[model samples]
Target: MNDKRKKLFLLDIDGTVALGSELLPGAADFLQTVKENGGIFCFLTNNSSKAASDYVEQFRDWGIE
Candidate 1:
């Protein structure tokens, strides 16, 4: 989140950014804001129970997909 510099936001989709079947408050807005402003983001997770696609679906359900 620097001015005109290379930046990236890495997000964890489990309890850090989401709770059981629910998205954390401001999580969507935070992502959307970064996307809308041309900021970069990468979702990095080490979930043994799921993968990136799983997060994709979950984020979609939370309106941040």
Candidate 2:
């Protein structure tokens, strides 16, 4: 474990992770991979038009944790 390292990923939800209201291709898989590799991530959005629960449901719809 000498090469153990920490990684933190900050991802935007609007365009990077999703488009309009749909999750982009591979976005879910990418997040899953990061978790599998012991990496941390935070998903954010500048738009406040939607509620936090909406985002959670969106992620759930996209099959992402």
Candidate 3:
């Protein structure tokens, strides 16, 4: 695999980083670690109930993205 180039980690919420209305353990830490290491993040949520702005607001509330 080409691990030379930087990677962009696409993480999903609603269980991966959160559950319904609650945050998951270690999720923020993991995201920070990767971000600090120069990795890109693109949050992907399966719940189509909300728009991209909604997701961004959620992350902002968590002080994450």
What TM-score would every model get versus the actual structure?
0.73, 0.85, 0.80
Residue-by-residue lDDT tens digits, candidate 1, 1-65: 45865468887767677776788888778878888888878776676787667777877777765
Ranking by lDDT: 2, 3, 1
lDDT (Cα, tens digit) per residue for candidate 3, span 1-65: 65785668887877788987577989889888888898887877668899888878878898886
Worst 10 residues of 1 by lDDT: 1-10
Each model's Cα RMSD: 3.0, 1.8, 2.6
Per-candidate Cα lDDT values, in order, are 0.75, 0.86, 0.81
TM-score of 3: 0.80
lDDT of 2 by residue, 1-65 (tens): 57666589998898899998888898888888889998989988889999989999888887776
User: Which residue runs does candidate 2 get wrong by more than 4 Å?
Assistant: 1-6
Q: Could you tell which candidate, 2 or 3, scores higher by lDDT?
A: 2
* Runs in model 1 lying further than 4 Å from the true structure: 1-6
Each model's backbone clash number: 0, 0, 1
Off by over 4 Å in 3: 1-6
Ranking by TM-score: 2, 3, 1
